[model samples]
Target chain A: MLSIKNISKIYKGSNKGISNLSLELHQGDICAFIGANGAGKTTTIKSIVGIHPFDKGEVTLFGTNLQANPAHFKSMIGYSPDTPALYPNMTGKAYLELIASLYEIDEGERNKNLAYLLKELTFETAVHELISSYSHGMKQRLVLISLLMHNPKLIILDEPFVGLDPNATRFLIDEMKSRASEGVIILYSTHVLEVAEKVCNKLVIFHKGEVVVNDTMEHILQKASLDEIFRDVTSDD
Target chain B: MTKLTLLFLFRLQNQLQLANLNSSNKDVRRHAFYTISGYIVAFLMFLGYVLFISIDLNIDNNIQAFFVLISSILFWAFGIWDILSGPDDLIKSKDRDFIFSLPLKTWQAKLLPLFSKYLIHIGLTFIVLMFGYLVTIAYIDHFFLAILFVLVLSLIIPLLSTNVTFLLAWVVRHVLSIIKWRNHVTESIITLGLFVAPLIYLIRSSASVDYKEWFIQASILRYPLNEINSFSFMQHIILLIGITAVTTSLVILLLTAFHHLVSSQNAVQSKKRRTNAIWHTHIPVTALLLKEFKLYFSSLTYVSNTILTPVAMIALNICILVGVIPNLHSFSYDVAGFTITAQHLFTFIMFTCVMLTTTTSCSLSFEGRRIWIMLTAPVSLIKIAASKMAVNILLFLPGIVLTAVVYAAIFQVRMLDLITIVALLFFSLLLISIVGFFINLHFPSYTWNNDMEVVKQSKATIITAIISMITIPAIIAVVYTGNLYLLLLIMGIEIAAIIVLLQKISCNNMMLN
Candidate 1:
């Protein structure tokens, strides 16, 4: 279970990034955070990932205060940034190993998980090659493999499917489904309402740094499609 | 084939122009100007020195110097070529992907730029050399004949320099193909020396060159003033023309083979070759350390900067020893100590250089936005810092040792002094590692795209290194004599103890965010 209380992020600038907000998320839930460009989705995610600190918020992850043991909290949550930063010179395997080593994966288990993940993702011998040579889609597949199947409390990503081809996207969608079956909380941010409608169990519509609605798909949809719901909530802002 | 080389060369010129304007690697642009400007100033200085020296020869040094300066101006005219062509000619840049898949031959792409850039490089440097000759021409009685001979000499000099540079690198590249151990050994040595060229040169220039003791000198160009202009011009020209043509042919053949070599290097990166063997087990910290090391070493730019320069130091020694760079400026052989040998002096230079090059000073800057990865990864920040520190030490050790051996040989020092020097260098290295850690920690430039900025502009690194260099000799002097060794031991303990103190400070800093 994840709970956010009194999460008020007032970004006072030409374009504010976040404002007073509150929400709760739980396992076996795929929460789609939908917002337009310059909306608070990325900023909110950045704060959660500790990439950027929030102005004011007390986040509690699985009953532990996020700040009390930030590293431990982070280690239990796998994050894939909008543009995944892979060491260009590192091979797919090498990059994965670096992450795995940090997550403190055991040798035998790491090998097994890596093999299974790579196979599922259809990564070839190119896994051993330098990522400097990898295509954009290949880089995403590697990051996806890094995030999944670790029993992480939360899986957070920003536009996880931006560069992926159709086949890779389908494979990724299927992987996310299986990951969710294991009671993992998946928090992904995207601007595509259709994608959010299809993959997400819960929907959080944010505009001008405030969450207009965050509830189950049907409840938030309220006799209307996500696109209509999005238009209604975001139009005034 | 030459026609193709010319066409390919023109395209490279265009590409180079783009690189100068657009290279994300900013130093590539700056270094191009620096090399050119350094030549210009150094040339002017050289002319001034030559003019002063010529006065004793009863020659009108001013006229000679003025002519020499003009010759230098003519040389700088080639800077148009270099600035137009840029370092992008030599380096593989961001645009290679678009160019690589094109219908062009690989040799056409690679050799044209390599050949053209050097052509310009020689032009720039040779102009300076010609300025010296022009000054001498003004003093000579046969001014017309001197001018005529000098023109021929000037053209041949750049041609000769370009041909020699191409041939030397070609030979080294080929020899590397055949001699595996030698290539690695040589590369390591050059990488080590890159850390200390100025220091090595300062030490060497300060020391007296011993002509009778052949092994006693690291510079082959000893007494450059004695023979800078004395070589038979016509005879050398005839000889040089022959050498240039022959070398040009060999280089063309080498260019033909370069395609295969680059493809092989690419295959290793692109085809997913097997990694070097890894141990079956590793602690988390060790694993992270290995990853950081791998990241640095595998990078094309970093590897070139780190390993290639030190390994190439052998050639530098040869150049110095052979008097390749004409002594236009007054120089000395005074290094750390007058008693220091060429080999030991070489070591000290590499030691300082490697310390300079290892670049723990900017590891934080290198992190960029990805610093959160370190913060989030659950690894101890100190371990990350330690691994960075360890990588630098391990990488520099081989090159430093090579320089020390060479220095020991040149100085004819006993084993004891060598041992003492090693101990002193070792402590100095330790002190630098600790201080470098704090320098980086105190003021990390997270936005730097260039290692040069990180290495050069990091105020802490510059200030600390300057301070260290001044204090090192004095510390060694004291440490060698009395209870200073105990003091050093005490100092090491204190530094180790300070890690705790620093951790508290860092924790507070981390809290501020």
Candidate 2:
């Protein structure tokens, strides 16, 4: 289980940040965080992944506190940022291998996972080229492969579908569903409400750095479409 | 505003990061202030050094013409080095597609980057020429003539240098286009040449020639400086007009070639598929070390800036051993009342080289926006910092060992003296590596537009350099006290304390803004 309790993060010299944001995801739960721009989606994800520190809250992964045991806590999570920022000088293969080493995956397992992911993502041939030559979609696919090769317990992706093709996006949704079935908790933020409404089991809508709705996706969608729901909840802000 | 003016303003603002200086956030504003202040301090120090050198030249023999000749040679060498090191930014900017998409003429787009480059060169040349003006006034005692000379030289020098650099870049790019694997081959060849040329020049000059006399007599700037010193007003005007005409023609030629270069750059070559490659895994720290090494060598700017000092140390050691330079064993200098030997000077140079050649100062900032990888990984911050320092050590270790062996062979001192010297050097190396890493941790900048900003201009780099400069003399003084063992013990304890402190800091503050 992943639990974030009353986490608050305010940027220095600015009032724009997540405030008293709280959420929880049990095993086998796929949660979608939907929000407008600057609605604090990325901030909350970053805090949970231990990339940004929260001012007043506690985050724990399966009873392991992030502040007390960061290495172990981070070991159980895989994170992909909204935009993939990769080393241009490194070949795709080298970058993936480096990630695998950092996550301490065995060599045989790493090679097997990489082979499967590369072929499934349609990036087998271009993996030998330098990342500087890769298109945006290719870079996104590489980031996805790196995140999945380690087989973490909790997976977090921020805007992972922006640059992906339709086929890759479908593969990603299917992969999330299959992994969730194996008791891996998945959390991702997106502006694509239609896809989120179809794929996610749980829905969390953020409005002005505060969570306005946290419930099952089915419960929220029974009233109106996600598009209308998001507009109605965030209209005041 | 005209399109060209708007483009120039955009590039200038990006290069200077002016928006950050005017940011609404207090922390951002403060950080920008400190960084800009650091640059101002560095510039002033450079200007002061040039002025002092000019004054010294005057005192020696009133050789103001020699100073002008030397400065011109420096300007020329820098122009050539600039071209040989990297691609012309005008032709290869990252925002090429966006800028070209705008409603603008091709000539306006091409002229923007060239104008930016000119601004930088003009700023640098102005500093050097200010010293030239002062020297001229001291020698000729004519303010108006000195002003005329400075004005004319400033206008013509940057124009000439920029043209020459563009022409050379065009020629080199065309030559590299024909080679297979151009990027890798070009970087390696240029890096090798940059490293080797100075060594050969120093060795040859030390072995055979009186360098100062040869330089003054053989330099192409001698006649120009003489003509200016004679205050031949019409001749100066003619020379300026001639250089202007040539540079204008060169600019036209470059503008015509711009489209062809841009199109050729877009032509992609097919790469061979490596389908059956074996994958290797290592411990996380070793993996990080390998990554750091790749990053250090991948860019010519990084390698050339950090590696040159260590290479100079090795070259100097070879020179001393081969008797091309003075024999350090028998030489001694009486400083104040203490007698310092050539061996001391040799050790001092080695220590200074180690201090100057640290890649740790810029390694963290060099990651730029990709620092998210390090932050999100399961590895501890200590491990990441260690990998950076380890690369610095590995780079310096070979040169350090070579110098130690040469020192032992040349001095033939007792075993205890040799042990003391080696211990001092090793501890100093550890000290600098840790200090550099720690300093960078506090002053990291991940928003740099180019490697030069982080590697050469960032506050972390400047602070690390200042600390190294201060430590070099202090270490030398401690060694001069005949208590090398005491100094070694102190340095070891200091390193231990810093490591403990760094671990604490890293654990508490791992997130970068």
Candidate 3:
């Protein structure tokens, strides 16, 4: 559902950001994007979501070139950043409602999705409180809820499981698997190999700014475990 | 002493790194330039005050006292604010956790971070007040003593103010807790008391009397500068030492008490939850505008500080219109003994109204890291910019209208002139808001940890100030020429230009590094 082709974002006076990075994900695919620190995982995600303008190459969402129709492209994708980059003073429900309105999600659908998600994520009571007062896990759950509120076809979550407690983490894993089963494209970056091995059917490994591996998890883990493979792949040249 | 020295050096190294970032990064450099321009404007204002005192008023004693008193009060007010918010930086900092995990003494670990964060505030105050002192002092030459007094007073002011603030807070909290009152009630009462005291006084006394005179008289009781020249050298030394000793000891005692009080009160009063019922509105711009207002109003510090100048301007205009203070010679320029007319005074007010409505200028920066949501949302950037502009206009409209109405009634302006005045001020506000929004788009700083940095200290605000310096004069010229057709032409062209600029900024690139 999403295609990133030869995209390179070079920070001025530095050789740090992504370089000639490319990725593709289709429906019913949970692509686990694994990388070490500064491996251009976030840069690539940001570039694809149109947050950081790439210096080179094109990104297409559901056959629509992002530059040609950015509005349509953005509407079809749900991006949940690593940090809960939300208005601190806003209530969780207000933020979700805002996201719903922006994505043109109808009131009935928004309410149904919100109720289910709040209960499932165990943040039903906390939704009325200010987001500023929420714990890290609560904020992560809220961000995830906002991401799912729009029912976007493609979901891009960066380090989505960082602050989730064990219960929430299990729920998130189950939800991703369920969404993937329902033919939604899930692209998530994480350092947690065990979760990725268990939940993600496809694995894409990034070293430096370039993708080193893009194949099924079974194929990548044929000889070694996910952790050993990740260590071997990201080790020094 | 050794730990403090090492910690101070580490703090200094971080400051140097920040300075380097400001110089090396283009975006940071631009922001630094704007912030420095703000400082330059403030310094020039101080210079103007000095010139007014030296040349216009030509009164030394009262004016000197006035300057000292205003500065000290301002210092104390900030000190109190810092103390109320200080514990957050002290007890709740992630850095504190990391430092505590290291090998450090109790006081060293606790006080070093607090000092590193707050001492800059005191030091900057010292430098600015020293400049004010140098300009105001006309007595016998004691440069060394003057410097010493400024330094000593700067230290004493924060120490004394923080001590008093916490003692009062502790007392209020204890008293309220005993009486079955919530902690927020105490906070609200304290905040209300602090804000309303000056407001009530200003309303009652400022309209009828020269506000400077009131400040000059009050200075005698509040500031030590008023009494510095009266004492002999030995007496001055003794007084300084005595004040320092008392303030320092009080601070030490208060710090211990503050720690205990905080430890005892683990259950902070959480505000009642707000209802988050979704009101599905068809208009996206309205949603964005409401969001802007929500964010703006939720920050008490942002609203109070940004609104203070505009509120004071309105009050001054009222004082003038009512013939209470007779006339406004304070802001008027005496060029070749020709006192400018009230029209020029109205121009000054318009200029101030445009300048003080900073809601639009820093709104983008205020988005901080959350800007990603806007960038990735299906909503157009024009809608975002328009929402910000609308909020700015709505915020300044009531005050501008009230002030303009009073001026019109007092000046006996005809309907045509009143309409002209209102139209002109509204157009100026639109133009300034656009200019500020554009500058922010170019030099946005989203890395700020504090809202104050984005709202007040960003490069966008300074750039807006510089643009105002140009726009205000052009506006004055338009009014000074008094051609109705030309005024219409200018306003029309400005609206068109604003539309085009908004379109260009949105279409090209909305985010800056």
Candidate 4:
């Protein structure tokens, strides 16, 4: 569903963001992209989502290059960053409507999706209030609603469970499985090994801006527990 | 006490340490340079005033008194302003959780941050006022006594102002919490009352020259400080002590009451939920414009500050219409011996009202961390920039058009000349908007803790103000010379510049700070 080919991004002078990083995802795949701190997981995700321009190589979403038509390409993919980057003055409903309009979603579909997400997240009472007054978990839920409102084919979330409560986290894991079962590809980066091990169908471990492990959950479990493998792979020499 | 001292030192370092901001960040460096340069310029201006006073010491006593009186009034104004917005800087910040989590008492948590923030403001007042006193006293016969008097006077005024302001804020907050209406409405009303009260006083006082004269005479600074006898000197000291002691007692009483009145439950709880139907525009740009309006009107600071210039313009026009202030016109002679009456001086002044609204300059920075929404969205960058510019122009256009019509009717301007002036105002507005947005695009500061920082103190805002200081005069000259073709040519150039800037902004993919 999504492809990143030979992408490279370097910082000002000394630091490296990503170097010749490549990744591919197929339909019905829930890939957990694991990495240590500063392992370039975010850099690669931002590059693929067209938030950061890569120095070399291309990102394609559903056979269309992001560089060729960034807007159209982005419409097919929903990305939620690690932090909730939202307009505090806007109400949750207004924000979701804005995302819908940006994707040119029809009013009927937009309303349906909005109602469903608000119901699913139990955010009906807070939808009318300004987002600045929302708690951290509420803001995260609103961002998730915005991501899912358009029903994008590819979902990319960065640390989605950071501020979520246990109930919300369970709902999110179940939702991801449901979305993947419908042939939607989901890629998320996380530090929680247990959650990833339980939920993700595929594991992609990253070390020093390069992929160290790319295999199915079954294959990885045969070698060692995901936690043991992640620690062993990412620990320093 | 130790924690208080540590917090004060930490805050001092946070404010004054240049190394805290990365030198490699272009926007940070530019903001630091511009802010420093602004201070330097203000210092130079103050030094010029000091030199002027030094040249003439005959009125030295009056000058010293005047400086002290002015300093007191200025400190009072700063105190009121701090009370309105300063609570958030100390009490309701991101660091509050971390600060309160440490081993500290409730009073320490409240008073330490308050004093640390207030120290910088009071310190500035002390330096400026004491410098004036030192310059005055260095030439006096009783230098030591003068120095002692100046020190006491400086300390007293700031202390009184601080305590009074805190008391006033506490009273207002308590009253607001007891009221029934939503928090924002009550706060907005109070904000408007505080802002309009001074203007109302100025207008009422401006009517009588005798009242103004009496005010000047009544100022303590007008007294002859050099001719003070022992009795009067003792009386002055007694009066100062009495005022300070009374104010301190009141503050202490109020502080105890305020601490009890204010609990976690008394925190500002905004329950205002917008229930109006959500309106969406057909065009994308219009949607963006609507979003801009939503952002602008939601904040009391933006509405209060943005409306000030237009209100002033309206008042000036009314004054001209009622013959309170005579409309200004000047005559210019061309090389061909043709006399031209430049009656559009008022138009220039009124058109310059757009300068008061720095919406375009701060719009991008106002986006803050959410700029990634624009960066990652399918929307074109030019569309984003144009929407911001369009909103600002649309905001100011109605006022400009209405005022232009009023000027045309009052001055009996010819059709062609009115069109020329209107066109001039339109082009100038567009030019300024584009320039302001372009500067913001290059030097955006997204990590601002307060919206006013971007609105008032951003490098883009100062740069835009400086540009207006030059361009307003230049445009007036172009109109003063009655050169229509030259105005047209400048308009063309401005249009071209805007187009080039928009192109550059859209095409470039620079690193996002």
Candidate 5:
């Protein structure tokens, strides 16, 4: 359960980001936050995660205000950046172990998740190698593993499937569903419409930093195809 | 008179800082600024020798001046060219191949940089010399002609070197594909040029105090610039022009050769990874450091930065202290158990080790994009910071101790001073390591396009190092002025301050560092 109330970010000394946008989510909800590049999706997500400050909005995780208690909220959420910002010098296992240690996961849960993620990602062999030597796809998988290490309640992913292989992509979609079914809320964002249309339970199309649509998949689909709606929303630009 | 394609070469020199840097490392728009600032700072620091040395009709007294000035320019020129062009030269995009596939000739693209380089070179130096000659000095026999000669000399040197380096880049880029000795050879050349030059020149010049004995090989610059016949200024200008014309012609030839050797179809084939000599050191942080170490070590830029650069600087100093320090070569070894070299070396070694802790300062900031993983993880913020601190201590401790011990063995360090040096060194590292982390944490500029930008250009790191370096000496001064009990009190105050600062910084680090 994540809630954003009137969230707006104005970068200092520069006029940027959206204004007065808000959203609320619940567990098992697969919300697709759709926007083109620079449509304030990142700004909203960052505000929720306490990475950047917002000028006119409040973000709360499980009824705890992010501003009032950031560390508490942060521990309960998993955020994946659009960019794979990995420590090039760190090995896959070293990185995973670092995440595990930080989350303060006990040895058993840490081992189980590390093993499961590495196995699922087909990275068991390569996880011992330094992340710098890994290709783009491998880095993406590692970030996913780091995000999933703690199994936080709400998952916020920014363009998670950008560089993944088709098999990895399939595994990701299935994993999101399974995780959601187990009562973890998923907030997946992408520019691609088809993936969002097929997987997301609730679709929220963002245009000009305001929510243009938010409903169950069938309700959003009743108006138009996801592609048609995306065109309509972006056509105003 | 036909125009020889001169664009007031001296004017270009005035605009050198036009390529100045913007302070923000994250923004790529300011790269032109970053690069040019680096170039100008490095270039101007070198030209200090030029300003110090008088260049007159008497070239003998100015021989040291000439050597220092010309070599400074060449050193900076090579550094700048390498800094500016190396990266673009390394990467050949699919689009570049496509462009080359078109009717456009390779010389058109390659020759443009060379021509512009001549403008830049003349622009870089000639104007300053001209200002000195025209505004400041009125002793010129032929002011106009002297300016012309300076212009020619300026153009010729950079033109000659840029073309040669471009040719070398093609060769090194290609040769590296087959054989990998390019780095070794290049480094050897730089080492000889920067460090061994004075020794070589001293020996050669000292042997030939009488010019007639070495008439054909009196000086490298004299042979190159023909400043020998300075009685007639026009002849001097003509010779300078002649050299430029010849060198330009040679560059054209080299460019033609480059066009042939570098085929249009060529792409930088991914290099085969080296496997011959793997490091087998079993260490805790080994896996984490191996990738960064390999990335930094294998690449010339990083290798020079992290290890080779400092070691090379130390080696250069060793040669200077051993060969040419004013009185060290013939100095006394015992003065209450202190050698002349030993005192300076102890202070120097301690300064260097504490400074060495700075190697880890930017390591975290370098992980700009990936910092979120550390932030979101269950690992306490302190552990993450400690891992980085450990790497820095890992960077600082051994080298410091080893060098101190080596110097101790070589010199008569009284046990008291040795203890002092050891205490100072450890405290210095402790102070440096903590401040280094806090600097990066508090003002972490993680989003840097250039590795040099993170290490060298980070303001936080530089300021922190300066403050800590200053603080240690200031504390020592205050402590030494008082009794041992007072020294203990001061150390207590420092430790208390550090702990408080650490608490405050670590508390805020989740946001800042």
Candidate 6:
């Protein structure tokens, strides 16, 4: 289980971050965080993944406090940022290998997982080329491969579908579903409400750095479509 | 304003970092202050040195011609590297595509970079000519004529030099294009040659040239005074016109070439195919170290800038051993009644060179936008720091050990002295590495458009260099008593204190963001 209790993060010299955010996810849960731009979706995800320290909060992954043992907390989680900021000088294979080494995965196991993921994602030929040469979609696929190769308990993705093609996006959704079925928790932020409404079991909608809606997808969708609910909740008037 | 003028102003503002001067953040303002102050102080010092040299030379007349010759030679000697390495700036600017897409004429687009290059040459030429004018006004009776001569020469010199440099760069690029090699490989070879050529010239010339005679002969005021005096106004005008014609022709050629080059497709070479897909695993630190090494070697700018000092130190040691240079053993200095030999000087030089080789200073900044990789990795900051320091140490260790062996072999020193020298050097390396990493953590820059900005101009690198500049001479002066054991003990204690302090800082500041 992953739990974030009352996390508040305000960027220095600015009041533009999440405030008093709380969320909990048990095993086999797939939660979607939907928000408008600058609505604190990335900030909350970053805070939970230990990328940014919250002003006040406690994040525990599998009973390990993030502040107390960051390395252990981070080891149990896989994160992929929105922009896919990878080393351009490194080849795709080398970058994935680096991630494997960081997570202390066995060489044989890493290779096996990578081979399967590469084929599934249809990036086998491009894996040998430098990341500098990869298109946006290819780089996104590489990041996805790196995130899944470690088999972490909690997976957090920020806008993972931004540059992906339709086929890759489908593959990602299926992969998330398969992983969640195997007792892994998945949390992702997205602007695509249609996709989020279809794949997620739980929904959290943020507006102006505060959570406006937090409930099960089955309960929230009974009243209106996700598009209608998102527009209605996030409207300034 | 016209679009071209707006573009130029934008580029200038970005290059000068003018926005930082007005930044709301106090730290940004302070950093801008320091950077601007550092440049002003360096420029004034250089101007002062030139004025002193001119006064010391004490020429009576023909000062304008004499200084012109000196300035011409200086420009050719130093300007070659700028020209050879400057094409990258023109063609590889981050905004090249964005700017090219705008509604601008082809001539305007070509003129922008040429104008920038010309401005740099003008700055160099102005400094040299300003001193010449000062000397001429003081010495010559025809003051207004001298002023006219200096003004005309300054304008003509930069124009001619800029055109010549661009022409040469065009030729080199065309040749390289024909060869069709990788850009990085070609750049590395050229950068290395630029560094090594001067060292080779110095070594080869030290034996053949007589210092006093060459200086006297080269200064036209001292030799062939009659011919210098006879260099009249008509001759100067003819020379200027000839240069202007040549420069105009070269500018036309340069514009044509720029248009062609910009239109041509950039060839992308495929990397060599790998036979196997398996990757070997290692401990985290070892993997980090291997990654650091690969990064250091991949960029020409990083390798050339950080590796030159160590390479020079090693080369100096070899030269001394081979008798290419005079033995330092005979030179001695007395400080507070204690005699310091050239061996101490050698040690000081080695320490200074090692101090300049702090790759850790910019290693973190070089990660730039990719710092997310390191920040998100399941490793402690201390371990990442250690890996960076390890790469730094490994880069200079072989040179340090080779110098130790050569020093001992030459001096036939006692075992105690050998131990003290080795310890002092090793401690100095550790001290610089830790301090560099600490400074980087405090002032990291992750938003740079060019690698040179982070590697050469970032706050971390500049601050570390300033610290080294102060620490090296201060340490040498304090330990002028020629007490080797005392130096070793002092350095060891300093290193220990720094390690403790870094530990404290790291506890409070673990995340780079």
lDDT of each: 0.59, 0.76, 0.70, 0.70, 0.60, 0.74
Q: Write down the TM-score of model 1's second chain.
A: 0.56
Better of 2 and 5 by DockQ: 2
**For model 3, which pairs clash?**
none
lDDT, residue B217, model 3: 43
Model 2, range B231-315, lDDT digits (tens) per residue? 4645656775596668757776666565565435424432433554777778999999999987877665677577766667767
Where is the poorest 10-residue window by lDDT in model 3 chain B? B217-226
| Model 1 per-residue lDDT tens digits across residues B114-149 | 565555555544555455556555456655655565
* Residue A70, model 3: Cα distance from true site in angstroms: 1.9
lDDT of 4 by residue, B24-135 (tens): 7555665666676676786677666655654443343344344434543445456655544433344354466766787888666655655665576667666766666666
Candidate 3 lDDT by residue in tens digits, A1-237: 788899998877577888887778889999988899899888888888888889889999779998888888889888889887788877887777678777888878877888888899888888888787888888889988888887888889999989999988888888888888998999999998898998888898898888888899988888889888888889896
* DockQ category of candidate 3: medium
DockQ of each: 0.42, 0.66, 0.56, 0.50, 0.27, 0.59
lDDT of candidate 3 over B1-513, digit per residue (tens): 686677677655444334534465665665555565566678678656645654433453445353456454554455546533523344334355666676877666666655665576567557666666766577425567777776766665555555445445555555665665643423434543553455456546654445554444433134444455664634755664576567656545545445555534423433645565644534577678878887766554456445554555566667767777554444555658756676576666666666556667788888888898898888877788888888777867776777677656666667786777678678778877888888888878787865567766777776676677766777777776668887788778778877887777678656443
Which candidate has the highest lDDT of all? Answer: 2
Q: After superposition, how far is residue B83 of candidate 2 from its true place, in Å?
A: 6.8
Best by TM-score: 2
Tell me how many residue pairs clash in candidate 2. Answer: 0
Worst 10 residues of 2 chain B by lDDT: B217-226
Which pairs clash in the backbone of model 6?
Answer: none
Task: Report how far residue A126 has shifted in candidate 4, in Å.
Answer: 2.1
**Candidate 5, lDDT over the whole model:** 0.60
Give the TM-score of chain A in candidate 6. 0.98
